[model samples]
Target: MKFFLTKSYKLFWVLIPLVFMYGLFNKEHSLMVNIHATYFVINHLDFAGLIVIFFGLFGLAYWLMDIFNKKLISWMTAYHVFISIFGLLILLVFYDEVENLEIDYAFKQTLILLMLITAGVTVAVQLLFPINLIVSFLRKKKH
Candidate 1:
């Protein structure tokens, strides 16, 4: 786990497969919407693009992690990566439920609110990057 986060290229390699898997997912969803008429009204591209953007930002962050410093607070990377992924999973799951569950509108609205909050938090957590950088740059010399 430590190596995964600290080694940017290794993590990037991991991310590539995830991105491709997501691409296949989107392709399947696209087929459903087009041929099967699945009634899944979610903009398939937007969701796919969301995943792409997520990976893109992570890749950039990890690369910067390499450039700015080889080390990071292990817990910080763990929290950021896990929570961001968790939030994205929640978003995708709730989106599917809200769209396809055939539940009450009120329940769906609640789900939407949850989605909104999760997204806000997911985005907010990225603020840690700059925070980490500030601390990194501001540190006094060991000499």
Candidate 2:
């Protein structure tokens, strides 16, 4: 339980606002147009809201993992990765709608790039870190 409330869990608290700002100011239509191609409405606030909620859920998962054992942490990490990837994909599909909503193109691009970079880093960390930790633990156990 104590682990669930650690600094790492709190770090995600900051991301909630970032997701909102990114969705609010970033153009989505240009990105979504290529994917949807027709009749997609841009809902900036709604998308931002969803991102916030997802982040909250992830935070809770982290908390639960922290309260449990190493096996639980590994499972939670996998769950977080899965959910985050799915959310990113959904956002990508509708990104062009943000442009249609009158957000500045440059700002939109910057936000998209930031989101992509963050997602990439997260995926990399999630995939490598846990496996490495588990392997290290196993080796230590053997010795």
All models: lDDT? 0.63, 0.53
Off by over 4 Å in 1: 8-13, 27-42, 140-143
lDDT of 2 at 100: 48
Please write out the lDDT profile of model 2 over residues 10-124, one tens digit for every residue.
6456677777776677534234322345654546566567668867766665555445432333444544454464546455444454444467779887766655565576465
Residue pairs with backbone overlap in model 1: none
- Model 2 TM-score is 0.42
In model 1, state the lDDT of residue 33. 28
Model 1 per-residue lDDT tens digits across residues 32-116: 2222454445555566566667667777877775776645666667667777667766665455545566778899777666777
Best by TM-score: 1
Question: What's the C-alpha lDDT at position 56 in model 2?
Answer: 76
Provide TM-scores for the models: 0.65, 0.42
Cα distance off (Å), candidate 1, residue 120: 1.5
Clashes of each: 0, 13
